[model samples]
Target: MGLYHFAKSLVYGLLKPVYRMEVIGTENFPKDGGVLLCSNHIDNLDPPMVGITAPRTIHFMAKEELFEVPVLGKILPNINAFPVKRGMSDREALRKGLKVLKEGNVLGLFPEGTRSKSGELGKGMAGAGFFALRSDAYVVPCAIIGPYKAFTKLKVVYGQPIDMGPIRERKASAEETTELIMAEIGKLIEVHR
Candidate 1:
């Protein structure tokens, strides 16, 4: 297997026993075409948890600082993780994300831009909505609900793809689309939490 799949399998093997991770609504994922997986972040483990559970490989836009870490910096790129500067527009990162989707790959993103300290879904940034409107990819909302206690259940729930047709046709602003995405994430958390 390739590095990404190998790492995913390894993580799954290790985390499954400890967290009793349960994945729901994976059937909601499309089998092919570009897909944007917009999820709410809660813990440091959120990215890997969602990556392993999703049916397809997810290329993530991780914080740029993560790339400066010693060993992890080298490993992240190999596992399909790229760096994105937070708290700014970061056009380069946005371009990279668009490129990933344009190539018909799955691009995983945390719409909230950072992890929540209180474990509640926070306001989403415009990035998720921007990508959805810019690309023809299916925008799938995901929720990672967990206290991440060992031997306890941690759930990753994938909600149905948000229909961007009407929004697109109406030429809705990215902020509006972001609100819709965050709302969908909230609903998923409500059902699965």
Candidate 2:
């Protein structure tokens, strides 16, 4: 098996015993083609949780600081994790994200840009929308309900793909598209709140 697949399998196995993980709306995922998985960021585990739970091998746009770590810098790239410089419009990271999608890979992103300290979904940044429009990939809204505690039930629900008509038609700005996508993510997780 490929490195990504092998790692995903190993992590999934570990998560199974640690959290009562439930994945919903699995059919909503595109069988192929570029896909942008937009999710809310609650904590650090959010990315890995979505990665292992999703139906496809998903890549992530992690913070650039993570890649600065000695060993992690070497390992992240091999596992499909790329660095994104937060707090600014990093063109290089955006380019990498577009490339991954163009190659028909799943690119996992959290529109919020950072984790919410209150566990409440906050305003989203424009990065997710930018990538969505640039790549013309399917935008899948995902909500993660738990893993707040070990051995606790955690639910992840994938909502229907967002219709990117406004984005496609250039009728909406990146900020506006981001708001719309974040709204969908919020709705998906409302049930668990």
Candidate 3:
């Protein structure tokens, strides 16, 4: 297997029993074509957790600072992660994300931009919406509900793909599309949490 799949398998083996992870609604995930997998971030472990559980390989946009770290810097790209300059409009990162989707790959995003310290859902960023609209990919909303304490139940719920047809038809603003995405994520959180 490739590095990404190998790492995913390793992580899954280790975390499944430790977190007692329960994943629901994975059926909602499309098996083919490009996908924009958007989720609410709560902890640093969120990205890997989501990646391993997802049926398809997910290329994540990690913060640029992470790439400066010692070993992790060299490892991130091998595992399908690329750096994005946070707290600014980084055009290069956006282009990279679009490229990933355009090639029929799953591009995972945390719409909140950063992990929430209080574990509360935060505002959705326009970048995710931009990707969704631009790529015309399946926009899948996901929620990771967790305290992450050892042996505790951590649930990852994948909600149905958001219907982007209307939004595309109306040529809605990215912010508006982001609102719809966040609303769907909120609903998933409500039902699962």
Name the top lDDT candidate: 1
Compared with the true structure, what per-residue lDDT tens digits does model 2 show for residues 61-157? 9999999899879989999999999999899999999999999999999899889998889999999878877777899999988646888888999
**For model 1, how does the per-residue alpha-carbon lDDT over 72-98 read when each residue is reduced to its tens digit?**
999999999999989899999999999
Q: Distance (Å) between predicted and true CA of 103, model 2?
A: 1.9
**Candidate number that wins on lDDT, 1 or 2:** 1
* Residue 80 displacement (Å), model 3: 0.5
* Models, CA RMSD each: 0.7, 1.3, 0.7
Clashes of each: 0, 0, 0
| Candidate 1: residue 138 lDDT (0-100) | 98
Flag clash pairs in model 1: none
Against the reference, the lDDT scores of all candidates come to 0.95, 0.89, 0.94
Per-residue lDDT of model 3, residues 53-94, tens digit only: 898999999999999999999999999999999889999999
TM-score of each: 0.98, 0.95, 0.98
Q: Rank the candidates by TM-score, best first.
A: 1, 3, 2
TM-score of 3: 0.98
Backbone clashes, candidate 2:
0
How well does model 2 score by local distance difference test?
0.89
lDDT of 1 at 78: 99
